[model samples]
Target: MMTTAAPFRPGDATPTATIRTRFPALRREHRGRPVAYFDGPGGTQVPELVARAVADYLIHHNANTHWRYPTSEETDRLLAQAREAVADLLGAEPGEIVFGANMTTLAFHLGRALGRRWGPGDELVVTELDHHANVAPWRALERERGVTVRSVPLDLETGELDWAALEAALSPRTRLLAIGAASNALGTVSDVGRACALARAAGALSFVDAVHYAPHAVVDVRAIGCDFLACSAYKFYGPHVGVLYGRRDRVEALDAPKLAPAPETAPERLETGTLNHEGIVGAAAAVEFLASLAGGAGGPRRERLGRTFAALHERGQALVQRLWDGLGGIRGVTRYGPPPGRPRTPTVSFTVAGRSSDKVAVALADEAVFVSNGDFYATTVVERLGLASEGLVRAGCACYTTEEEVDRLIEAVGRVAPT
Candidate 1:
């Protein structure tokens, strides 16, 4: 009786077009070459669907929400659509989804709100694998509110979160645990399910940063049982925006220092001032773009999620494995995270032994291969691995990336490896 699930095929036309079709800008070639985007960890290249949604919002529904005019009513409708779309994307309730400018700002806002609850002697358990956005807030709380910020070390060899360190770090005084669902630098997907359970047992709330994880796979906050989750739209092939999901009760109870006239709603209260109606509308379209990749609909919720994600996952694993194997075969590339054919996203970071990360980035750029270099805002990881001064070069793949693209990158990296 389920009508939402869609059967997935390896090479369905609809999904293939959704994966390959690009807007004019995204398809624009510089010097007669397509820009191969391996910078997905930072953000994704938007499709025509998302671009059209943004334009449609600005042209047709330009007014702010809840106003009296027709434009305002349309804007309100768009807002509702945005909420529903984002909620469905993360398997959350519409009332639980809150909009923000970006994940870093949202995390800070949420942290400040949560920080109010913890005073002197209260502790926050954080990982060395998290971005500075997740680290600095708790450290600030420690300095200002007399709380203790404890660091949970990582297993550098495996590029994984150290559970023993995390378990021992938590105590009755622990108030929070901020962990990334996947390492932005290393692409090591952590066990948020276990982390959430541990947080609950330790009488603490868990915040999961899914900004990196959202694009590669499906996110079910309820399944993971985390307290707060944040991810960016740009990272997921949408416009530049962020989504924050909070349990209704917890969001309602946050003593956020907001305007006197702020709406007393679970989501609206946390949303603060005016939102990016256009970006949000575009985010809805982005979700549509992803769902469209699920083939046609006629199955159960679990079945649908499973079907679509299986295709995406297989594609991702293949591309990642190809890149890993290709890089490994060549000399001087010390790649991080799970090995080739491992259960991880296709985001890879590595050092050239003889070449600087900046040099590798520059060499790739010359060939119209766009990749990133440096910590990627995952400051704690870079510092932990002595890659802070000059970060490891990163070449990340998306659902849109092809086998041909990975081969090109490997060939280019090999040629540029200090030869």
Candidate 2:
């Protein structure tokens, strides 16, 4: 469990103005208007601090790990520090953190490793609400290893997991329950703790895809009681890097494919090769940047992070509420997912009548309101929503997102909406 910090009050919150200034991308102008980045769910803009950390590592500490040189030692230390930062971010031990190219790669790697032990008769449970990264990896195990993969149905009306279906899917043959902590397309935050508990009760290990959820909430792996969890740093305000947390025993026991000369340690053995040293350094800097937002709140890094997330979540709730209401009032705008007050992230997906999602996004972009459009790799969710052709226009709120920006997005979207 994370150490409790003082609850975040409005007075304790960092000003959005101050946070905006830290991201250089906010200065960008598009179509003569300042770009209001609503594509944060796809990838957040990196703060200058994170960029500087990456540059500094490349320029000064460019060396391989664990050699007799100062730069090499420094590289090792920086990598370790990166693990420590991600550990605090996910409420796991530093040694349990593994770095890879991205979450998808890590999940696929883990899927292969776990599949080596299971064949026909062993089962894996995936979800229709999950991003295909979580679904496809385990499904690959079916084709390769002959494991029967079951999918938990999605509740279309509520944009939530079908709890009854999920419960029915788990059985004694289940080897693992792979679930996403949140739906990237719909911002539906699943009850992963409950999901993990069910998986545990069924005598199955659980793997959580936290890539979308980590940016919006504080992830406590222990509280979730999952055997493994994966998140991408880029989903937050960091570089393009994936982090995985594994139980020490689970990681050490995996028959992961690695070079014979590679370190046989739990975490390192999971990582395929020499990692992106600079990206990993920047990832740590990203965690530091997030903690710094708590501003003078003295506590452990996790406590500060908890405070920051608490404050940001409050801000996100308001922003999403405004966006939801504004779009609801507009003609031809059909919003998807759970409405405001539901357990969701500060992300919204919608479609404008008579306009394809891409066209709506293009029109919004012309007005300098950048939003993402498409299945967003949560293809199953979109397919389940029966929006296979129209897709979805997604706008996500982040720490730097402002009310003014939210209003601008609404206005821009209004102009594009069919009267």
Candidate 3:
């Protein structure tokens, strides 16, 4: 018989009190009020352990790789360990993981490298719901390598992709399919498995942008069957670092541009120049922090992480539902994206009828309820919604987010909603 997955109940495995204490930033106050970070979609607050790991790396193990010195050797070992840690989180092999400055930079680097193999007849498929980081890099190939970038339309009202349009875009000429696992702007989760499967049938390689999805769900590279996937460390409770996971054979075959003397390997071949060694070390610590949320006792790191994310996802869904329902009840407040029961992240975007998004954001900030405003680098989504000029105010929930905090945000937005 198939075994049931480990149980990860909210109160049993990861209580709010136990989880909140781990983040040092939660102690911070804004204008005498304790800060509630509802801006996790932009970047998450780092935990003490992750910060300590960064500092420890810089203080004791700071050096270049492949040297005779002790620090250099330690640096090499730390990097390997970091790779393994990230690999475990993604359910991928260590060699398949590549480190870079951030997801955008890595995407550009990969796009340029991949562009080398294609010419005028090649096409790339992208969706309107994706963040610009996923859209812009492939679009660049159109100008540089005569690539035709085809876009899949989004259902603006539902905040979901048009699957029919997606299928129509994936012709045999489609060289690569670039899609986001979740919409950072609308919180809509796409069917990445379906997208990847369709791309495979069309003989097209698939690249999944999982930056927003990583903190909210479990990622299995093998299960998704994507050729490549990318996410940012800062999007989770880690330092500012970018991670890319390419399939072993695909990564090994890429003609990545690197220094002549650099180590020529699957991951290192894609990674150029000296990396953010401290940040990489802290990124691993962040993954460990997530694993620890499920108590870290019974199983391996990956198993623990699976349990932890399951619990976090359940908690986040509850909080997001409260926020969504609360916002919907307020006067003159127009909420965007899918409703509470839909497949989505713990992110909500909305606009006050008479208030610009920036004005609402500033008003909320005065009450120490921090949130993000504007397109959030999701320009296409805003333009498609016809709110390009005003954009949308976004509030996202993190692991430490409390029900009380969600109530406060709802109360604050109610106060700012146009009469």
Compute each candidate's TM-score over C-alphas: 0.95, 0.98, 0.98
**For candidate 1, lDDT tens digit of each residue in 130-232?**
8887788778887778898899887888888889999999998999998889888988888898999999999999999999988888899999999999999
Model 2, 170-287: lDDT tens digits are 9999999999998999999999999999999999999999999999899999999999999999989999999999999999999999999999998899999889999999999999
TM-score of 2: 0.98
Quickly count the clashes in candidate 2.
Answer: 0
Q: Which pairs, if any, clash in model 2?
A: none
- The local lDDT score (0 to 100) that residue 293 gets in candidate 1 is 70
How far does residue 194 in candidate 3 sit from its true spot (Å)? 0.7
* lDDT of candidate model 3 versus the reference: 0.94
lDDT of 1 at 314: 77
Instruction: Give candidate 3 misplaced runs (Cα > 4 Å).
Output: 1-10
